[model samples]
Target: MSLRCALQLGIPDVINSHGKPMTLSELVAALPVHPTKTHHLYRLMRLLVHLGFFAMQKVADNHFQEGYLLTPASLLLLQDNPSISRPFVDLVLDPILIETNNCMSTWFQNDDPNPFVTVFGEPIWEHASHEASVNHLINRTKASDSSLIGRAVLVKCKGVFQGLNSLVDVAGGTGNMAKAIVDAFPDLKCTVLDLPHVVADLQGSKNLNFLGGDMFKAVPPADAILLKWTLHDWPDEECAKILKNCKEAITRNGKQQGGKVIIIDMVMGNQTWDSDDDKITEAQLLFDMEMMVCGIGKERNEKEWAKLFFDAGFSNYKINPVLGPRALIEVYP
Candidate 1:
């Protein structure tokens, strides 16, 4: 709730744009609230500081007065940051999702598929389909996240797309990932495959095309198929089916130079470095719990991921732990 309050109040953006550690008076002045509420603002800042959203430093003489500064987590909330996670933070903490937590108790008593249905009177996707506002929020959140991931992938994981002539981003939300790839490799033809509604209003570029279709039925033929955080939204069997389609899509490229599927998703227990071990693993587990509550999915460890690949008829696979908890998996037939 405090985090939500902070975001609503634009505290992170305020402190970030301040260009220096923001004093309490400066923050209060910048806030839209009444001047009489300055003390209340300080209380809120104190709590947020304790929660690690902001850091407090002694400023005035004698270390009596203090100034507040944005932390790494708060920095991601800055409105101007290219990779701002504010939309994701807002979406996950939205009132619709928050209300579902109360239904968890009753949800376990009944035989409902998930708690989301119990609260929203429909499944997550069904509800999103009916609610235009929620659907827009979800799409925006996904696009923002993709932009952040795309920047990192283009810079650090360029090797994944080196020799590939054609690539398809299956279930690609708004073509942010495809745009990034196309920008980096203009010669590589890129296609974004998603639902009709998702691609309806989205624009395409010279090298990137948007295709409206279901992955369950077909994916466009390409030298490589990219599935970024898509498989985790499904059960193991469903994921296997999607992987099979990806395999078929790659095979369509030809038998002599059969292609591969590039997956960017969480692979639990694959964290090798200390940073990955602590931060990435913890975030993945948290996301797993979130998926369990909100959708019919869970984060998979490497062995589990590999099992799905093999079950989908892939002959060889390699996992590169480059994207935090997520890995760049290459599956070849």
Candidate 2:
């Protein structure tokens, strides 16, 4: 939660605006913190520095005159950064989500879908739909992460969108991913398909539009369907249903010949490890557990993913393990 506290205190932005490494006394003066808590701030910074969020840099030629500087990881957390992931950090550390862990033992002995359901009496999405603040937080979190992931996809897998004349982003929140794709591929028409409540107020341009609908029922017909980190939020049955809908959408309108579905999600044990650090494996495993606690989804291995694809009527597929812990999968009908 120290990261969240740093975000809450706008520490990253403060250091960034300083234009140089910030001294301890300067940070204390710039912050709203009480003078008596200056040493506490020091302790927090020490921990953060050790954790690699920030670094201690020498202000002058003396080792004793060191100042705090934002590290590469913390640079992306700045408030004004387009690829900022602060909202995601906020979502994971939210009180309601954190409390779900305490109910996991109860959940295991019950018939609940997840611990969040065990505590709140409904699935997270169902609860979020009824709670405006919660819904906003969830959407903001998705949008923030999408901003980063979308850029990465464009950088690493630009060929995926090369020949596509039209595409649809399933469950895309606030059109962050679609917007980036549309900006990169100006001639390609991109549509964002989401719930009615989520897209009701969003505006679209000539090449980019928003459609409110359910992926389980139908997806808008397009040359390609993009599912970025969306399938991991659903169970196998639900994922199959969604993929079938995507298949039908792509096959409709006589576009079956070259249509495909592009999925960006975790493929368990698919990442290549250079050493014994195994940070990617650790993240994927932790995310799987987080899904089990927050929802009914779980990370899938290649075999499990293949079964889902074949069951959904997909004829061929390819997995590109280039996105760190996640993989970009191309499914063809």
Candidate 3:
């Protein structure tokens, strides 16, 4: 939550705008905190710095010997960043979700489908579908994540879209991923399929459009199907169903050469990081628990993913560990 506090206070933005290390007093003056709370800012900064969100740096300013500077991880917290993850942070740290998480023990002792169902009286999807506010938060969270992860995929795996003539981003919230893809591949027609409420008011352009549908029932036919962070939101059976729909979508035209399903989601125990292995592992673990508590899904390893693909009637698959802590998997039919 300290990270959320920093984002709330616009600390990263302040430090980044300074262009140089910002002294403690400068940060105090720039922030909106009251005079009495100025002293507490130091404690917050200390914790944030220790957590690697910021670094203590020697500044030339005479007001203080050291100042705070934004770290690489903190850059994503900047409000103006195109790939800002603040929305995800806000969604997870929201008070309602926090309260739901607190009911984890109660959920364990009961027959709830998940902790969210335990507290909210229904699954997250039901509540989000009925509650406009919750639905907006979920969409915003997915959009924020897609912007960040999509940038990496475009950079590292642009080839994944090269041969495809048409693509469907199943559950592509708000079309952020589709927007990026369409911009990168203008000739490649792109469609964003999401819940009706999620895409109801969204607009599209020449190469991009939106469709409201359920992945469990059917996915729009396309040369390639994109499932970025979609399947991990469901259990094995549901994932199998989604993949089956995707298989049918890709093979609908009977053009077998370039039809494939491109997935961008976390693959458990698949990191080959030269450093920060522990940090990546911790993030994957935390996200796995988040899935378990928030939904019925769990992160899958290569073996599990392969089993799901084969069971769904896919011929073969490939995993590219290009996205840190996540992977870009190509499953072919």
Give me the candidate number with maximum TM-score. 2
lDDT of 1 by residue, 1-333 (tens): 788788888889888888777889889888887767767987888899998999988775537777899898888788888777888988888888888866778988988877897787788877876688998888888888888899988888898899888999998988888888899999999999998888888888889999999998888888999999999989988998899898888887773256899889998888665863888878998889778778888899888988898898888899888887788888888
Clashes per prediction? 0, 0, 0
User: What TM-score do all the candidates reach, one by one?
Assistant: 0.93, 0.97, 0.97
The Cα error of candidate 1 at residue 111, in Å, is 2.0
Location of the lowest summed lDDT over 10 successive residues in candidate 3: 271-280
Ranking of models by TM-score: 2, 3, 1
Which is superior by TM-score, 1 or 3?
A: 3
Global Cα lDDT for candidate 3: 0.90
The alpha-carbon deviation from the true structure for residue 255 of candidate 1, after best TM-score superposition, in angstroms, is 6.1
Which segments of model 2 are wrong by more than 4 Å?
A: 61-63
Cα lDDT tens digits, model 3, 1-333, are 988988888899999999998899899999999998999999988998898899987887565489888888899889899999899889999987899899999999998889998888988888988899999899988998889888888999998889778999999989999999988988999999988988999999999999999989999899999999888889999999999999999889564766999999989889766567777888899999999899999998899999999999999999998888899999999
Where does model 1 exceed 4 Å of error?
58-64, 255-258, 272-276
Candidate 2 clashes between residue pairs 3 or more apart in a chain or in different chains = none
Error of 3 at 68 (Å): 1.4
